[model samples]
Target chain A: MSHRDPLTPFLSVDAARVRRNVERVQAAADARGVALRPHVKTHKVPQLARLQVEAGEVGITVATLGEAETFVAAGLDDVLVAYPVLLDEAGLRRAAALAERARLVVGVDAVEGVRRAAPLAGRVAISIEVDSGHHRTGVAPGEAGAVAAAAADAGIEVAGVFTFPGHSYAPGAGPDAAAAELAALDAAADAARARGVEVPVRSGGSTPSLAASLAAPRVPDELRPGVYLFGDAQQWELGRTGPDDVALTCVASVVSTVGGRVVLDAGSKALGADRAAYATGFGRLLDHPDARIVQLSEHHAVVELGDAPLPRVGERLRVVPNHVCAAVNLADELWIDGEPVPVAARGRNA
Target chain B: MSHRDPLTPFLSVDAARVRRNVERVQAAADARGVALRPHVKTHKVPQLARLQVEAGEVGITVATLGEAETFVAAGLDDVLVAYPVLLDEAGLRRAAALAERARLVVGVDAVEGVRRAAPLAGRVAISIEVDSGHHRTGVAPGEAGAVAAAAADAGIEVAGVFTFPGHSYAPGAGPDAAAAELAALDAAADAARARGVEVPVRSGGSTPSLAASLAAPRVPDELRPGVYLFGDAQQWELGRTGPDDVALTCVASVVSTVGGRVVLDAGSKALGADRAAYATGFGRLLDHPDARIVQLSEHHAVVELGDAPLPRVGERLRVVPNHVCAAVNLADELWIDGEPVPVAARGRNA
Candidate 1:
């Protein structure tokens, strides 16, 4: 351990924890006869995505064309860029090139996207993104018909109707958000069907709402939960996953013990600056769950010793980030069993 | 311009703005007869650091030893690692190697760090970190003497003392935070002097508090302000800088227009998720400051059109992140005059 104690403030993936999480999600998806297309945005490592696929996922879901390109280059053919990608000439060109070697399905919420993607209409496909109460992106459930019609009008393949239950991220909103996704997917499918689109694919799921949504009599044909691969503090606090399910942890060394404040080297840069309103702290101490990361600076995470023993300076601690997706995006690579694996799609915001 | 329209969600630094910012901070530091040791963590671009050095910064400040190594390897001779690095064997080894290459000064706030760096007792020097009002890292102003004495006890070089007025990053707290920094630095210097430490370097300054702290009769011997190079929304809102002073912007494409919500590809991943209590939104649109970034997901930033005209899908907008330091840490590179400059020490959170 001394020889391999990586320079403090690094991300490490527990392979066992990862396998447990993958199995848990895959088991749920398999039982319900739903196709699993786990979002790769949570753990951007190609190896992790491949693990999920081997564990029974149909394909993989990504957030951007750059991410899709990464996965495709890594040899994953089927990808759903599940964001309303506003395809400009560059985007269209990139999509066209990607389509040459893989099965790609972009996402669209407005007619403008369909128009912009007209150049690659036949080669590439698009899924209608429904709002489903997240209100962050995607059109409302009823508005899905117009977007689907525009895709058909543009001669683009309407792959399906998909929505992200992002509202599930809120405190105690899992069941409600799941209900929203269920209703939204159902309405969107019917609306697209009414528009004479086959509506062959209906996809919806976010880690927080996936479990609750699965309890419904009929779930979406496809699921795209991202963070189930590495449970985050938000998911753990929201009752979506337990502590044992968290696969990733930021290994941080205690750098300061000023006035009893146990400060860790893993600050915002390492754990990410995501303190959702409901999040107990900036992040959670994996070993000492009682401790709270009260503040995060550029390179210091100040903790409050809440029944947890104050960590001595130079002692290492494992931290669980609030939003694993955002946190993982900050790292260049992640350590798995003492070996490093590049975050293949990290910094793919473009 | 057409050829240079980068893919959505990337960081870009304007050369002119950067020059103006450097000149602005440098001019003030010169007037006060203080040294400029600009923190490079905000930009993390080697070229920009060189630009600042050419403009007359005495040295560069980094958050980690790895960052110091980057700048040192890039030909920087002087560096001050501004974080209280809790050095283990690996950390000590890295510090010793860096000290041999550059005039490096690591920060220390606790006796434990002094003990850990005992092996590098003669090769490296350390500055006592003083807690002004931020109370993040560092010892309280009065404890500086005890910590400095420990370094002396360990037969290590005690350079001086420094503090970050992080509390200045708040609504209408700039002046008070600066005042607190001034008093803290003064007390720390006196404390160190009492402990028979020379305290030649009395460093204290954050971007928000730099100007106000300069108003004191006598400023510290050195100023270490990072964000002044790239004005963020937080600084602009605090009246520390104007819009023109902002050198960095996240170039993001409007990807969705669901109902009235204008969603950009610059979500938490691109623009960063640091919305301080005082910040108006997740981030500010550089061109359309009237628009509010109401919400941020992993890959989507939802904006409310507040007097600002709605951006069309596929149209790109420049956004000023609320915290430039956190935002820059997420990007792999930054565009400078249509050329990509790698974030030299990005992800060097250690």
Candidate 2:
């Protein structure tokens, strides 16, 4: 150890803990005959992405073209951008560059989107994003085949389908949501098959729903979960994972103790203001789970400890954010087991 | 410009607008006979900090040692950390390093804090943080003298006092709350003077309170406002600034538009989820202010244009985040005008 305090408000990813999560999720997928294609958005570290590949993941799923580029630059051969990507001239150029390095896959939902991506038809593969009840993006599951057919008509190779089971993060919804997600993927796959298109890869899974959903019979061909590697307050509240499963935490120092409240140095800037609908507090205190973050600002988090005593001014405590993905995006680097490690692919937001 | 679709989730700082705000706030401080030391936490961009310094400001204020280190590395001299920092060995060491480049000033509230900072007493200057009715951090106004006296006894040079008029950020409470902040700062100054302390600097002012408190004569010797440089949704809601005054905006692409709603490529990952207490929606759409951000997932923002029509998919829009500071913290680089510039001090979370 350098004997120096690691960055105060940065996420510390325990490499060993992250490896355990990868194995746990990989085993779950293997047990159900599904391929695990872990989402690279959570860690956004190319090292972790490589570790997933080393751990026998099917491939990698990214949330942005920037992420795909980062992974491709790190020698990853196959990557899927699960977002509804609009291929403007710049996107097409990036896709062209990415095609040279890896088998780049882009997701689209509309006919215009297919037409927009026509320029990259031969350069990159396309996936139709299906809306499996999350209602955020993607075409309806029944309409997935139509979009896929349009992409095929545009000389683009349709590489199966994908959906984000975002609602699975809600409390009491993971298993059912995952089951619904799988069913929707099946429906989309059936639609594609009806058109004589072979749907090779079916992807969907969030951290909260990964275990429950990936365990179902007839699991999809691939799972793209991002937050499982960093179990946050939402995962803890939903009982998807135990406190010990969390691999990443925000270390903050006590900055204030006034009026029975202890304030932390890390606030929205560090922990992010991503409050899970199921979570009560802003974040869970690793050292004191009973404490509640009653108030948060850009630079200060006012913690209200009920029966539990708060930490002293000089004390440092680890904080598990309510939403791991947002928390990871807030930080520039990660402390690997309390050691600051640069997130090489961080800020690659395209 | 690289013509890469503006990097889907990058923040763009409008130089013209930010310069206008800098001049406006500087004039407000000058009218009140207070030195402007705008807090650099909101933008975290060294260029903006330098702009403020050039705008006849006394110094810059930061909330973290990481921020101080970043500014110091950028050749900024006088910097005050507004938060009551805990002086761990790491903090003391970083402070010592910063003291070599800049006049690092830290906030102290208690005797233990003073003692903790005793190691770096000869290296850095100290500022007693006084509570101005926010009930967050800092000691009582009357206790400022005691803390300053303790720091002075511990061989630390006291540089007067500072307080965050956080309550002034509350909507509709600007003038009265700013009055309260001035009164608290005045009381602390009086206490310091009575205790035989010089009490040269009395720092106070927030974005919402700046127009009111900073314009009031004899409010304080120094003014520190962070969010004004990058006016956010909170500033718009608090009636502190107009849309034209907003300098920073998260420029995101419309990834998907289905069912009369548009899904933005930027989610909490880009805009951040720091919804101010009175934020009307998840964020403010510069082009479509009426568009309600119905939901925000990890990597997607769902904007529901119920009765109002929204832009089509692939259309780019500027989004004013609820809190600019938190949003800046999430991003690693910024698109100024049309160029992607590294926010050199972006990830200094320590």
Model 1 score (lDDT) = 0.85
Candidate 2 on B165-241: residue-level lDDT in tens?
Answer: 88887877878878888788888888877777777788888888887875565477777888888788878877787
lDDT of 1 by residue, A145-246 (tens): 887888888899999889888778887787888888878988988888889887888999988888887887778899898888889898888888888888
In the predicted model 2, the residue pairs found to clash are none
The regions of model 2 sitting more than 4 angstroms off are: A1-5, A215-217, A258-260, B1-5, B119-123, B215-218, B305-310
My TM-score estimates for the predictions, one after another, are: 0.97, 0.94
Q: Itemize residue pairs with steric clashes in candidate 1.
A: none
Which stretches in model 1 have alpha-carbon errors above 4 Å? A1-3, B1-3
- Error (Å) of candidate 1 at residue A69 is 0.6
Lowest-scoring 10 consecutive residues by lDDT in candidate 2 chain A?
Answer: A1-10
Model 2 TM-score (2 dp): 0.94
Candidate 1, residue B117: Cα displacement in angstroms equals 2.2
